[model samples]
Target: MSPRPDTAARQQPSPSSPPSDRVRRFTRAERWVHRTTAALMGVCVATAACLYLPEFAELVGRRDLVVRLHEWAGLLLPLPLLAGLASRALRADLGRLNRFGPHDGTWLREALRGRRGPAGKFNAGQKIYASWLAGATLVMLGTGLVMWFTHLTPLMWRTSATFVHDWLALTLGVVLAGHIGMALRDPESRTGLRTGTVDRAWAEREHELWRP
Candidate 1:
């Protein structure tokens, strides 16, 4: 025999080992909820824009039809968000997001200067956005329902609800535009949100404190 079967040469150790210390930031279900909400929000916003824009109104004529579509979209908007909130893990993450400390302030200061800061799991801005979106969505849903069911409210209340609903929609649209721009600004972040996984380097660089 050329060599004994049990006498093969041993291999040397490799420079790098497999990652065994990383933590799971988002579960599969949580990711699914996030993605679904994002998709629905995109469609709703686009449809609302088409209905609102004077030039595009001809394509989606009939005020009743536009109102019905908007109402349905608004009704569906909170499902994913509420589902995600049902997970205990996600609720804990929300708690972490709400916590504001010295680090968060420092991160905001640096962010304002056009530099990346040491953001933990989430920066101050992200936390604020999450909170704002939560409140805005609730407001939108309540006001939207009042507008949709005009028979349940007095004429003046319905008019006020209509004003609140429209203004909140406009505000949320602008905020979402900023959110999308920020997501696009960082390829790794965008990838993470899309795939629910990110490279170790990305986590370390952007959220060092988050890695276990």
Candidate 2:
């Protein structure tokens, strides 16, 4: 017999999602965590441009303020996620992000062929993206710290950190733009992120492995 789908963890009913046809895709806590992280990242990127790009820097004369904001935002980037550890729903979803099962492989193959396939609460690509994002966040944080406190790090490491931090910031901006574009293009995903629930039919069609 085939293994069953992971059971849905229900929460307080959302007014935006009708009871008969909606499925809980993200909990309120999960959405808040995502929102907080996005906001912090945006600030970091915006201030980074102000500090690093000459043209952008010309538009803003407050170098100290920009540096302070960027540094603090980078430092606090992980707070929401850490605080979210108190959320059972977020913990469960994080576990899902950590694993790749058979359906994920099949889904990835079909995706490469330009067709959709069965996916769980998170798809294979999403799993990979999440992993990459987590790793990148940590690396950026470490590099940012080294760059910030120049006295502690060796000159060579400081130079290396600056190089990594700059290039990684550029790469993250591109990746985040793609992520935002994809989210905006998918109404169901946008709605789910905003309201913490999605149409059951949409979930059934797109995330079949997540359904019972």
Candidate 3:
């Protein structure tokens, strides 16, 4: 028979452990960059919708006003994104998001089944959205420049730019809504993004695979 459990083992208290504290994840500069980009994107989307939707445009009229707002927003959009890209930590995080690994495939499978799997720092869906946003932003910037500086492109090219710009804006707006919804689904996640630090339990539960 197995040895009887020791009364001393049960009676003696376990070794004292230090209390866990939440650590700062994103630096102030990094959080600033994220906030700046999000704000600019929000304004750009709102104004673009006003310009595109006939009912909405009628209320906000003057195509020139919407066009000017979009141009300025386009100019400001790259600043924060570029700053984030320059940071070593942010760049590394972006690289991790770009990578498609076996774990990502497993996560995707579980996601399709309406089940949650162990997610790393960013899951496959988030990675795809990030990539799409980065690409779409670049495309929008280039196209916007062509439209803003009409002298740079022929009339046909300008017309094409209009089509491309409008469609991409609508698509990105939809994608951004989904991304924001996912982030807001978990209160901890929204708090983390807003405050740049999350509870240790939240980190371990949602991003255990993220090793710094």
Candidate 4:
């Protein structure tokens, strides 16, 4: 007599089945917004460098063109994020970024010791970075607008705005460089952003609280 058919089916894995090792991490819309924001921010940062660095300014020439490009790029920096709010998942995730659980503090403590604890989709460090970037972008936008409309403002105010804008841009550039460096060093994290899926084992090890 043949072994039970149901038992046989349960024993054999399907050859054409999708890989079970991968789990969806980011939605397509999330990835789209992330890429768009990064591209726009990159343009803003590059133009800023060209405008500020004497060597780059001389090499690039067309100071006025670079200034205009930088201003426009800065103004557009928040658009991708605003558009992403249309996605329910993105909206929900934004809320998640705002809330800090006991586990988050634990994660930070572990981080200080060169270790990490089980964290949710966004770790404590990432949440802090996202929050900081959101505020920084708004501040940049406000100062940028004031500088762009310098003719409408008092000369002193315009000068102040320019000072604030320049310093903020420099700080943001440094922070963004660190962000890029960390992303480059973590292939699994990078893969999640690019492919919207992370290896199940990788996710479990890095973000134990996250469930597929």
lDDT tens digits by residue: candidate 4, 141-171 = 9988898887788988888988998999999
Candidate 1 local distance difference test against the native: 0.78
Per-residue lDDT for 1-212 in model 1, tens only? 56655454334333343244333456666788888888777777877787778877777678677767777877898888677887887788878888988888888999899888878888789999999998998898898788778888999989998899888889999999999898888887766666556667778888867844
Stretches of candidate 2 above 4 Å error?
1-18
Write down the worst ten-residue block by lDDT for model 3. Answer: 14-23
**In candidate 4, where is summed lDDT lowest over 10 consecutive residues?**
10-19
Question: RMSD (Cα, Å) of candidate 3?
Answer: 8.0
Question: How does each model score on TM-score?
Answer: 0.83, 0.90, 0.83, 0.90
Candidate 1 segments exceeding 4 Å error: 1-23
- Alpha-carbon RMSD, each predicted model: 5.2, 7.3, 8.0, 3.5
On lDDT, the candidate that comes out on top is 2
lDDT of each: 0.78, 0.91, 0.80, 0.90
lDDT for model 4, please.
0.90
Cα lDDT tens digits, model 2, 1-212, are 64445423244454565587787788889999999999999999999889889999999979999999999999999999999999999999999999999999999999999999889999998999899999999999999999999999899999999999999999999998989898888899899999888889989988988963
Candidate 3 stretches greater than 4 Å from native? 1-23
Q: Which TM-score value belongs to model 2? A: 0.90
